[model samples]
Target: MNQTQKIQNPETNVPKTPQMNERDFVNDQLTTEKYMTASYNIALNEASNQNLYQDLATIFKETQDCQRNLYNLMFKNGWYALEQAEKQKIDQTYQQFTGYKTQLPYNVQ
Candidate 1:
């Protein structure tokens, strides 16, 4: 059957989808991870107890791992695109930051 005929057929076995697809779901989770990571950082900073801070820190690392995994999956699926920065640009940034080193009170020498 032609492509149009398959789409037009009401008896087609195509599964009904919600407003959001798998990509959208992953994107939503990615956004949630950002907020969750931020919240964890804030809580960890405000935590006065060492044990509580350690627990929050552990959870924060897990959240970061989850975010990284999701990013890798999205990149593999072509849902995410990352542009490579030129070496010249990276060198320029490095030089800019390194220039501030002399401004410190103590000398490296």
Candidate 2:
């Protein structure tokens, strides 16, 4: 079908579901709020515990360091890939311009 027809009759075969009742929706929202409040209280309690918080902080710092190292490695790898691609493009340009029979030496060795 063309774009206009498809847009006008998009997903015509799909069945529409019934909407939720107001009472049920309100009850779901209240339950979600209660759970969130409980979770906050638990987090506050954990934070107040000095030993637990100290251990958590150490673990968080280690995790942060690990993530930083991973990011650095990935960034270096991406840079290396881009450098290789640029070198390839330059080599192709040089070969086209000079009519070289073989690729130019990339290194001294």
What lDDT score belongs to each candidate, Candidate 1 first?
0.78, 0.49
Q: How do the residues 1-109 of candidate 2 rate in per-residue lDDT, one tens digit apiece?
A: 2222111212112223486644344445545555555554455456977887776666555555554554444344332122233555668897796755345665332
Between which residue pairs do clashes occur in model 1? none
TM-score of each: 0.76, 0.31
The best candidate in terms of lDDT = 1
Local lDDT at 96 for model 2: 90
- Model 1's alpha-carbon lDDT is 0.78
lDDT of candidate 1 over 36-95, digit per residue (tens): 999999999899999999999999999989988997777766667656566677799989
Off by over 4 Å in 2: 1-46, 79-109
